[model samples]
Target chain A: MSESRGPGRRPGRRPGVSDTRGQILTAARTIFAEKGFDKATIRGIARAAGVDPALVHHYFDTKEGVFIAAMRVPFDPAVIVPLLLNGPREEMGERLVRFILTVTADPQAREPVLALIRTAVTNEQAVAMIREFMTDALLGRAAAALGIPMLRMEAAFAQMFGMLMARYILRLEPMASADPEELIALVAPAIQRYVAP
Target chain B: MSESRGPGRRPGRRPGVSDTRGQILTAARTIFAEKGFDKATIRGIARAAGVDPALVHHYFDTKEGVFIAAMRVPFDPAVIVPLLLNGPREEMGERLVRFILTVTADPQAREPVLALIRTAVTNEQAVAMIREFMTDALLGRAAAALGIPMLRMEAAFAQMFGMLMARYILRLEPMASADPEELIALVAPAIQRYVAP
Candidate 1:
């Protein structure tokens, strides 16, 4: 509380408010990693950040909203979902694979995704969040853009994410640590087949 | 302590032993399903089954032993792992996919597997059991059999299970209703590429 919370604090509430939000996110990341998505409660996060619970509420409307911020995920369909539908239909497989790989391969983009997948398996709300996000934001939007059945876009996600989970999360075996080129070469074709006429 | 204890480490003792073994297995299965693999306690299982806590010990040597029995998963790697690894290397993908789908597609087999995957995310033992089973039986063996680095094999498994989870558990859209032949066509070739020379 002694230090100005603002970017250029002159001992004011507004300056401290900014610092408080940053502290919350940093504390959230730690708690999420240590205890996992389920056990990382808002009260715990508040305590970790040395902030009032009310301040936590002010920043994040709900626990879900807090999680969305902590994850740093850009789930907006407006950004990339349209990209999925905008391209040549025949090239969808490669484009899709590339888009997923490029985005997920980034370290910054991965944590929230890993959290989503980890929690979705057991927590009903997390699972609902993932499904809803995919349908409303990414897949559904893409399906509409491409003029394909919405079901097909969803199917593509199942196929893509299934491989991702097996490789990334479970780290099953050879597949977990396969050569990227080999993976791209082999998988691109099937993906191409799926989207190509 | 009324009946003859079966031949084992503890040595000759009670007679109602056989009945208690069955009870332990029954209790273990229910407890494992309800509480997941790790949280379900041996003493708790015995108590639920209405028997002496020591009775479970008189039969199964450890919690892991009870888990194997209750899940009806084979303890030995020599059996099921080979199914995924057998046949020509080039067709490993098709062979493995066929084996998994055919073996697990039955309603009876599918129910327990769904339970295993669902719980594995939340429970340590469930994850440990699956990881050990995959490592000792399937992945490690497959790596040794095919003479590829284990890491690549691990990657392949991530892909395989990722697909399975998306397709079977979440039933993601088109994949949920995909024709068996279509899925096989799309997935097997990629698997073949990952595992083959």
Candidate 2:
């Protein structure tokens, strides 16, 4: 596939002939917000962007890829995955919890993650996309690296997800207002039990 | 107040006063859905209901009260509070987890609670109302009965809340489909650490 390019770059409706990827992303975001993720399809997005469905696939590969690109989370899971994997196994819980707290401490930095969560709850497509991305790129890798079952990794993640929702969204007292260090100390052990090899 | 009431004839809008309460609830719900909890005021609800704002106050003491009534969950915290407090301290975690699972297992019963969670995320007023109700009626009583710190009880609750969100709302697998007994076994010890006397 990489050997087909010429110096003139033949401009036709064929794949890689035009740059309509950004337009498709914009259309996808609008449709996702209006109709939600599950109902919004590649064909609909392509129609909105005035492009062929094949072009959408050529650029983004899948709806999930378009979502991940559109959502644009503030940090890269790739970086966090390695950090969690390379850490001391015993202290992995604390490290992961602390990382979540640290990253989310700033309101602006936390918006994209929150938006993804909000969208996920409302849309099955978003849930599947997030779950796949999280499992394939981050949690699954960590579980394999630590030699723990995938279920255990998911449980630990579920707890942390709930904790974030309670603190940031529900604004429950003490849990919401507690020092991050204190919370890390309190919750890390529970997480440890789940993720520990 | 009791002295003012006659034997067969109670005075001053006793309980069923022209079905205004129900009307107010409907209006409050509409307004809350359209404008969210914080932005939807008692005056706005009264306006929507075509009643005087004073009538709204007489019917439901505050906006929080109106929101709670509008978002009426099927179960009563009063009943569950006694159950949790009266149970053996060691088994409180299992009892609470089981209770949450059992109640939420039914889709009809779970809808209001899920609605409350969805609304609370977007609206601070909803959060404050839910948090107060949870703390004052349920968690606070359990903490006092067990002689555990309120903060610890809150942390335990936060984890359970997160677990529910992950399983039901986020549809995170394994946690979503895990057998109740297995989940009880896995999470009870963690909950016990937070609530145990």
Candidate 3:
């Protein structure tokens, strides 16, 4: 297929590329949904996208990277993790709480997250991907930076995770509709107990 | 249909009819799953179960009642609510945490609950049913008994709800395998602030 496309076309650096990346992402979402995270592969996604395998790797460095892109998560852990670590240790809990709320405050921005939550509930592969992303990309960095055990970090993270589900997904009242500052005041202390350096 | 069955047949009462209630419950689950709680009716459930609508009403007085029965949740609010309220105000959080862990420890017993959680994520009607159940049957009674505003009660409940999802559904490690007592110690204080009378 690659040979038939053109004589001068290179797998890694295809010239005049316009929508190839977008097209690959479209195909990735479908393939990932159908085969799940564990079974879906770069080659399979490339084949589905009608692009070369090397091209898929060139555009998205890894499967997890592809997932992060396809899911359209607004903030990258690469940026957020460092920001979380750089903040004052005593206030990290409040910062973390504020971070989540600030990001999810916009309804349009929250769609991908809500979709991920819904999908993660039903799909084991999604769960695995989510867990990996949280532990490796997000929480692990915070734990490392604060010199705390990952378990402590995980407990704190779990509370925040629960809060998100309750307030957003379940729309549990009071917490759901409460002023963000009030909730931060209420929940930040609890989170601090786990996260405080 | 009553006449066709026979004389001496009671719409609400049939002797040696242990399975009638059970069959209705089975049918109710199916109908609820298919049409959701709002649209599933006593007549529809009865038809599916090959019974009379009067029998469903006789066995379960309301749709909420039928749902509770079908879910097979071991703890009844009538009993547990009093137990929660009677405990020391400071210990209410611990008791609540213990209650959730105890109820969900048995995987078989937790099946219906986990199922409801998963279903409620995607279905608005299911969310309504769940919110009503949690607010009315469970948390409302607790708040009333504790003499606290429902808003405080809801905040605490949301935290617990999130923990259950993270531990059971997402299976995020450490929390998933943590000692129940340790978790209770960690989370009880947070809950007490909400429920303390």
* Candidate of highest TM-score: 1
As a TM-score, model 1 comes out at 0.71
- For model 2, the superposed segments whose C-alpha errors exceed 4 Å read A1-67, A70-75, B1-67, B70-75
User: Per-residue alpha-carbon lDDT of model 2 for A10-33, expressed as tens digits?
Assistant: 446344444466666666656665
C-alpha lDDT (0 to 100) for residue B58 of candidate 2? 93
Q: Provide the interface RMSD of candidate 1 in angstroms, 1 decimal place.
A: 3.3
TM-score of chain B of 2: 0.66
Ranking by lDDT: 3, 2, 1
Candidate 3 ranges beyond 4 A from true positions: A1-66, A72-75, B1-16, B19-68, B72-75
lDDT of 1 by residue, A20-48 (tens): 87777666655664466777889988877
lDDT of 3 by residue, A34-115 (tens): 5555567999888877789898899999987887887655446666666667868788778888888887787645655665
TM-score of model 2 (CA atoms):
0.67
lDDT of 3 at B60: 95
Q: Which ranking of candidates, highest TM-score first?
A: 1, 3, 2
Task: Please report how far candidate 2 places residue B108 from its true position, in Å.
Answer: 1.4
